[model samples]
Target: MLCPCRGKLKLLVVSLSFVILFTWLYLLVGNSENGRSLLLSACLVESTEARLLERDVLASRVREVEEENRQIRLQLSQSQGLAAQPVEGNYGNQQWVASADTGPEDAENTAEERANHSECSRSPTAEKCELIHVACVCAGHNASRDVVTLVKSILFHRRNPLHFHFITDTVANQILSTLFQSWMVPSVQVSFYDADELKSEVSWIPNKHYSGIYGLMKLTLTKALPSNLSKVIVLDTDITFATDIAELWAIFRKFTGNQKQVIGLVENQSDWYLGNLWKNHKPWPALGRGFNTGVILLYLERLRRIGWEQMWRLTAERELMSMLSTSLADQDIFNAFIKQNPVLVHQLPCFWNVQLSDHTRSEQCYTEVSDLKVIHWNSPKKLRVKNKHVEFFRNLYLTFLEYDGNLLRRELFGCPSQASSESTVLQHALEELDEDDQCYDFRRERIMVHRVHLYFLQYEYTPTDDGTDITLVAQLSMDRLQMLEAICKHWEGPISLALYMSDAEAQQFLRYAQASEVLKNRKNVGYHIVYKEGQFYPVNLVRNVALRNVNTPYVFLTDVDFLPMYGLYDYLRKSIVQLDMASTKKALVVPAFETLRYRLSFPKSKAELLSMLDMGTLYTFRYHVWTKGHAPTNYAKWRTATTPYKVEWEADFEPYVVVRRDCPEYDHRFVGFGWNKVSHIMELDAQEYDFIVLPNAFMIHMPHAPSFDISKFRSSPSYRYCLTTLKDEFHQDLSRKYGSAALKYLTAQRNI
Candidate 1:
């Protein structure tokens, strides 16, 4: 009954379907195993070629490394003025300048060093003189200057007649030198070398801090000091001084002619930093030695007799050849001299050269030794510390004092005052810090900790076999509870801490609300645990929970991921009370944050890619460096310099942050974590909490949020991770050091 056309159409449809079915079958039938095996075979053949290429690359790398070693050996030979020795070199060319230049950590402006830096009078009423002859060094954003200042403060502030012989590369300074010179009937003889005098002789690439820089300054100081002068304290500019300068002078005076030599303080008794320059490649630091350059009390007579100045100058000159390869400068000469017993060495009080923003503040507070002579602000946060208003003002004023008459006559008294209307406007932005800020004695004063603490929030989400989001909630709860216990047990002050735990876990961790006596007797550790069961908890809820919990006099909300170092208790106890802002009493007390297992190197194959990733944007998701927590509070625009979000910037774990108690506890208006942040924190009491973040203790994250690859962490205490040569512990003689406590602990943890 069907028409001929309809029958044909049906037949065509069936035939097309059959063809498609047969083709699919053909594809499925051939490769089932055999086709795959063939493809894999071809892949293996191609991979063999790849392996060959990799081998060639590796062989090329080995040759390149060998060449680099040759160059380094050559330079070291030239420095020592010896025939090139092939006894395998360690600090090859590229690692030469790897030494950090940010200066000493918690570097104090001691009265001793301050006495020599006479331009700035600490207090008008305070007696500012001590009879210490000189302590000199050149510092370009380093801890060495801090050490100098600390010694100066102790020596001079108490009215002891002290002359801090500062030989700076910066020749023209007015505020620190001339301004203060105008104020006092005092003598702080600052002998700043004319940069122009050596400009022609200096190489294209000038040496950074501590690079034969010390050696050059030493030479200059030797010439400047009187020939009869018995001694000189040659600090590298990073030490802190808490004790009187007279004590150190006494130590020098007590030493008989038979005893006095070049005295350098040593911190690490062992062959420390063995692989730092060599990167665990081999035969490093073993080629030389290690010692702390914080303070070096030199017997100038011995120095002159030994031609120490010549030694430093020659070494500095040789360092110029292989500039890119070396990380350390004058430190190397110090090591070589010390090794030969050319100078006497002494171990000073640990606190005198204490690394500022250290973790062990609590333990350090009780150690009864000389007051901190120099605070070495040596950690990574030197720039941040320098950015402080107090430090900035003081440094700016000092720079002006140290300003050369020529530059000032041209800039200040000449045509335009740098402190102009535009500059005044820039002051609020911290854009022109050098223009307006006044100089002061930043070290002699101790920072005080208030009653409020800002505890940050953290979460780790890992779905189980059941695919429930609740796993994260449990971890957050347990960690928060642990933090509470730790605070209750260790924290000495009455603090109100706010926490922002996200409800990423579907499981309700709040069930254990009263499990731990979070604050114990303390009233301020606020309990604002935010948990959203199935969905991402609204950022509003996260903040609100913290806001409602703060009932104490002050409040700060921070993350739970931070593990405080030993000194945190004291740092908080002391630094918090120093804040001049009103929020010091009611605003956020943001503590410092540092990451554990931080490494600078990445996979070569993925270098550009990782760079693209790490250089990602904060709020703009397109750029790869954007971490989850970098977004604005209300998802507002970024690049607002004065905003709280921008103000909160630091290299450490900012996500695990802190906030003030009086600031809006929670901005519930925003649905998620980052919204309404800048306006709320900065705009609300912009002047107060805006600058609340302080560089105190280094809070280490044991198992931090946004976890990283664990396998990559060092299996040993090798400093090779940061070095260029991939050297393990440098000294070949240190066979037993491999089994040290630190290495053992690392191994145990890796096994765990």
Candidate 2:
């Protein structure tokens, strides 16, 4: 009843009185706490909130009671689809995402009494228990990396795994089946969401690891819930917890006078501390807001009655709702709601729901061990940045939240204030997967790369001198040291080189590469060393290396083994010279590659191969390639083709020019044959960087040594074994990476 009408101070008391009366009426009508709160909101009143309060109160009470009873019957039969199923516009009682206007101070939005909402209420029954909802975002054993431990901990702490949830794709079957066979828990219901089944289909949310056709699945899960459920707790698989959420829920309930308030942590406003992204591609008031949507509790039936799901369909269709983008989709949408509808938003402390840390990622773990509620481990590589933030929170929970887990946590599902027997949301995401011929989750790019310019380098040697073209080519071809020089010479922006070392000299290289003037006025280059033993140094070492070198907003990585296809950037250029444009919205330009012509090794025996002189000169890399595939003809032939900065296929490159630094990027895993290059490319991990061959980009590979190392190529049994082992490992990794692509290219076309 305490409706603080901030807009017009004149009607404060009048609105308050009406709110009180409305609350009374809602109580008699058996309106849910959320329903009563919303019903009393003057924000939704268009014409006369006062008038409606005077007349509709008592009358609506009787109508609501009758509706409540009817809905209770439907609630009891939800499993039979009697209550969950929708009639026409929607086939299931779905929760539509709402889109409100930017009204007063973003804290208050213009709300109209929903006219299309199908009204429903429920009556309590003898059987009452807690229900938690979970979203199995991915099926491939959770790309987040902490899946097993997180899940196991939840099951151990909360005895009710069946009460958990599985909002995911079918491949999740691997884990879902494991859980099913392992436990005999009850109430484990699964709702396979087929996006194709929904009338409203464009996704308002994006599932990066899961199938793209999952928006409808969200609706399906919402539809599957029992009509009798008063509240639904939404959770992502990455989270873990220490606090008994019931207490948090209770707190949420207390602050929410007449409604069930949603609870969650707030995201940082600073762009740098936000999700992986810095900003959105499309220009608009940021979509999702400050809420860390990983956890939230909402009134299930109340949201369903308002047709929130349908609204989400409409909003997603018109607006961009992808949470993965610098937090554009899910997080952004939640942010929007809290900002626009402050009346419905229930702000919680940052402690409970924790996300991976950003700039502060290196800070402590467990926040004072006071009052912790949940935990989320994002990614292994990112753990250093994210895990400690959780620890910071966990520490706080253990210390101040006043929870005596020795006694509280001992009570099964009971932590601080909730009941026993443990409570975990059931996971059934494995049952829903999309296997269409085309991949909607990713957008494949088709590029045109042209062969640029090339010429014999100033230095040359003939095979007769051991200045022998065979040995010379073997050295120059495999040496990527020149890559740093080329990129620096041609590129006029930030250039990153993945070198093999990060020592004193390496630090000096970055200092110049990232200098403001060098990165701006001249050539901006940021070099990243590919450390053979990365652990010896801290990650901050690399970050500092980058910070000291390049000052440009954007940086490009170029491998030393690669060379610019002559005029590679000008293939599609309308003129010999043109204005350069920089942007994150699109690839500014793609690079065309070609190999630097080098001498070839033609040795016929292992003795002769290793016996050849100039281990420091012409044979600079010295036995790097001979270590893999030690066959007579092929090893000799393959060794001739080996290069340190080698790329497997066209897909393994980023658009770039030339640069040089004293970096040795010889990766053991990526060494030997063409195995290591794949690791380097995969390490980049940008979804957009997937190869798109540019018609103008083409490389004239300087053939490898054909005759110098012949002797070493043969009779090296141990070397052959190493080659075979590496090949097997490479193939397995390739298969894992390119799945279908590997099937289509590796074995299918034997003669290519």
Candidate 3:
């Protein structure tokens, strides 16, 4: 509607406005991009500076640590010089000039020497000499004997000092601790790590191996061992060393200059990883023949630095997604990791770990049996494996089995008189064993190295002039541990307990005792663990262990189920003095009784027990079933006599007694349920020890189910026949040991 000139002006204005708006938008977008770029660059620069500062700080700290270590090494060298002078006896051995004796200076030097010696001895980080570190995982009772044999072999050939690291359960730790503590080997040290602490790390991984989670514990050594320990030699319990472990330790040198090699392992001797052992065998992924984990040289520091925990965990997780469960546990995981990262493993000579499995092809590894350095009994059948050379290997294993651990304490050098003589004897014995085919029948009766784990938990026994200072020596299986608290509370004296159980039961019992209010706090109780070796319960063996550990002058030898009368400890104290027991070979019998009820009010005095007896509430222990067991106590005379009454020993007499600490040890051959206690009484009688019945002292046997051996004796004809044969053999042994006169107390048709 406007004129032509006005419309042209409006169109021009509109175009100008559009151009300005577009230019403004371009400027705003360009500025935003530039700001973002500048901000990112600033951030990058700041991050780089922070990282550089952190690196510099770390370098400074490392330098500080290195300087400190150098200073420590310098000080240690000076201290060693001071310590060596007095030990060498050089100054005393040499004739010194009189002027060399500067009195005050000499005193100061001696004081400094003593100070350095004390510091070196007490310092945790002091390294006076090189120590070969060995790691082992022993989890159960079955492994106790095998591990002992392994340790024996290691000590037998070790020329240098050793420091053993044991990853163990409570039971195995207890057993190993007792053995090593008693050995007291100079320049040897041992440390224990609880296997339970590392269980969670590998417990989630499904394993079908017979060893359960224990088999996987080795996988966690890098995490379980101390951060200070950099290298270790891991061994299975069933291995025996033929040569010095120093030879095996030297293999670590081959891994040097090879950063990728962190673990040294012997190749698997069998075709286990070939996936051709059986039909449909889908073994885990592995290199040709894989490698054995039984003997591993672990570079712990390198492993940790390279994140070995994460690597193995990830590998296990990925493989588990495809497989149902691992067949060989940690060994499978190890092989799988090596297959993927072959550079991480350094293969050792097969002679180092000569696996002796049923399907073993390890014979090709060694030209002669002497070439084998380490023997691994990888099969469940042990010495009974199908190998043609089983006898030779069996003999070698038996040599360690029969080895005396005490001989290991002999000094290696310096003491020429005794140490050299004993060392020669040991060397000659070993040489003779090596020269002969010393393999004997596996079934032949022989002496075992029993009394292994003595006083796993010990009470310091302090003797008193009072007669109350008595120790109750008792034997029981783990299930019977429930009676411990009641007896300990009532007796008020020291107690030595011999527990016969498998490794698992011993662990369970330790846990149970820790949770117990009375037992955990008890300071007068000793626990000795006896591993269940054979099918039969070693009842006499358990008794001997308990008796041997009693430190009190008087020991009341009794069973765990029997609870002594109140004031019995005090009564025995007074009775010992009154009866002048110190000068006499006498055993004071504490007549034992039993009740049918599961729970009853225990008698506080002999009067109350007699009342219970007259009221038909209690009967003498095994009175109705086996009269001879307690008939020798002479209960009829005990009822009226205020003083002790002499009782003649009879066959099958087994009465609980308060005897001197030097009482005869029980016959270990009388195992299982029958004649174990009776044999002890027979031996006591043969030794001319008098049995006197205590009128006031008594013990009450609580009702419980019969033991497995007792049930077997009642149910199995073969068991009864074996017991009868053992009894006959025992009589013959007794006759041979004591004389024909020792058999005069035996009565024909006697109940046994």
Candidate 4:
């Protein structure tokens, strides 16, 4: 073995020596291409790993953004519930409202993070408390109007320190900034934000028309809202506050013990999920279930911990984007995720989001409307119709705008105090209006008035044969000449214009009537100008005068501001001709719409008016009283749909009426704003007359900004005298007629 090892060692040494010599030679003179190839291989291997790492980092960032979007949307959809419901709290007393801070900014706040939020408001002192962040997504003029009204309600009720986060576009930001700067709430700090900052986070989110892009902003709230703000309350634009919102903020305390419940919101009190549309949607709960996000309360700290990112992952996996309904949009997506994780939700009271959509549903859930803390007008009808609820809320909302304006004027120009009188504020507003007039004045208002004037005043009214099917009668002053012109121009048949004007106004109208080509040329039109000597215009008496002037077999009594729906005359002519004039005492009640924008030409058809309504160019005025069986039927049921639906008259409504014979004469008693027209409707209802709502025969009320001087009418001595006389006359008429049985029909609100 040793001999063989020695021989092998000698051979191995020789071989190793030769190998070393060859390796040295190869290293010294290797092929250049082979060396380059070996170096390239090493670089490619390292580069491939770097590329993979970079791709992963980019992908992770994208995923994070998507997750952020999901979270923000979830927060937004639920935030509306925040202020929708509030408990009676320490700040519920009127003392808090009185002690509320009225300054531009809160300077004494030292609130820490979400962990120490409760400590931030250790005292009732409004200044030293940390401002709770409240976010709302508002865009465009209408939405901005809503936000202004909403914030006004919030600040008006909340004496607690708060900051308003207005998520809006650049233009909306400027508008909201200017509007909020006027509010003198030191406890309130307003910050405007653009979704553009977080838009990239939701880049993968769908941009559908049903929900729009603003709805997506709520999805990024976890990252978008200031990190310093550990909690937030979100509200819808349509919400009205009736209680202290600080009580709403305190609700976060209820969520403290629960790990899964990060959102507190009101349930959909209406039959939102009751229809078959949601039957197949397994994610949807039982009928009359689910929540309305009109108002939501979010615990930001807890929301951050929740795996909201799973929304995106599941959405992708289930292909829900393509499967979901556009009508529900983000709301549907949120419901889908939360349905499986009910523990994450905090069910609030139905009164929180008092659904003012369907009365049946609203009654079923939120029975006590007066007890409701937040009124959520959830009906799409709210967008177009100024019903009783809308009217009440709208006026209340306008009060806030008026307050904001007055405060702004006071703070900026050092104007006189607004606490003086209504007239004083009116004067200040008038002065401001004058100042606005002096700027690069784009008189959209003046242009609109002029357009209406030209359309109504100049449209030629040609007489028709058959003595005009129905006489269109109206009572007016020279102030309503534009309206008269529109009615005269639009009414296809005979018209009766009964003017209750001053001597000067009568002369003014006489001059125009004699010179006007349209009015002067019409043969079938009748003009009765009765000059009035007093300041008070007896609206009912004047209407009676107009009604008495009707010469045709059938008469349609309406206001000067009302014009028949296009082609209504021909439809009425045909329909009335077919009726048994001797026996049929049918009273036709037609739907009325308020024109939202200035139109140079009248709507040619009801379809045209409806199209404008859908386009947001027109809106429906308050006909709420009509829906409570106060009228024959709720025209809203098919107001824009089918035609010629018969409805039994239950109670009287307004001046809108059509009668041939046997109908009671105008009361000639009720006076002032709204007057007592319902009494006449009651008389007709008692007579057992047939009521029909003509879908095709509608009226379009022209928009007008009546002078603020209309308010002065109530205080006028002449008006008071007229009211007394009318009240006495109404009492005598009721006593002489059906006794107190018809007393309920009187305009009791006026106590006349």
Counting clashing residue pairs in each candidate, in order, gives 137, 135, 2, 18
Reference-based lDDT, residue 512, model 3 = 86
* lDDT of candidates 1 onward, in order: 0.37, 0.36, 0.75, 0.56
Ranking by lDDT: 3, 4, 1, 2
lDDT of 4 by residue, 524-618 (tens): 66555443433345565656655664557787877788778756777777767655544677887766666656674666877676677778666
Candidate 2 lDDT over 1-752, as tens digits, reads: 22122223334344445655665765664457765566565535656766567557766765765665555444333312212221111101222223344433231111111111112111112122344444444333332223333443444444332344554443344334433332333434343332233424434355442334432343444565556655556665556666544444443343335353333333332233234454543322332334555666555666677665665455444445433332333444445444444445544344445455444321222224443446544443333544434546445323322222112123333323332222232122212323351321111100101111011011111222211010000111213443445444443323333343322333344444345442334322223332222112122222223323332333233333444344433332321112121211222222322222364342333233334422431231213543221111122323333221222333322233211111122223322223333333332322223222232332222233442224333555644565445445555665686665554334522432
For residues 1-752, write the lDDT of model 3, one tens digit per residue. 11123234445455545545655554464459775565576557677778578657856765665565565455544443343332111121212222245564354344333432333212122132356899999886557647878988999987667889999987688778767764556667789999989999988999999999999999999989999998999999999999888877875655564666788887787888988889998999997778899999899989999999999999999899998699998999999998888777866666678899967777655557876789999999988887767898999997887666656664544322322333355445554442333221111111333434765553455677554468889999977989988987888888899998765566578778878999878867878877665457778778887888777888999999988888888888888887788899888888989998898988777788889999989988888899989987888888777888889987788898888998889876666778888888888888888898988888888999888878878998866776676677777777888987766744442443
Deviating ranges (above 4 Å) for candidate 4: 1-130, 207-209, 274-288, 310-326, 358-360, 383-752
lDDT for each residue of candidate 1 in 140-238, tens digit (9 for 90 to 100)? 323221432344344333334445665545422221243223222222334444433443333333555435434434545556666887677666454
Candidate 1 overall lDDT versus native: 0.37
User: Best to worst by TM-score, what's the order?
Assistant: 3, 4, 2, 1
**Superposition error at 734 for model 2 (Å):** 45
Model 1 alpha-carbon miss at residue 748, Å: 91
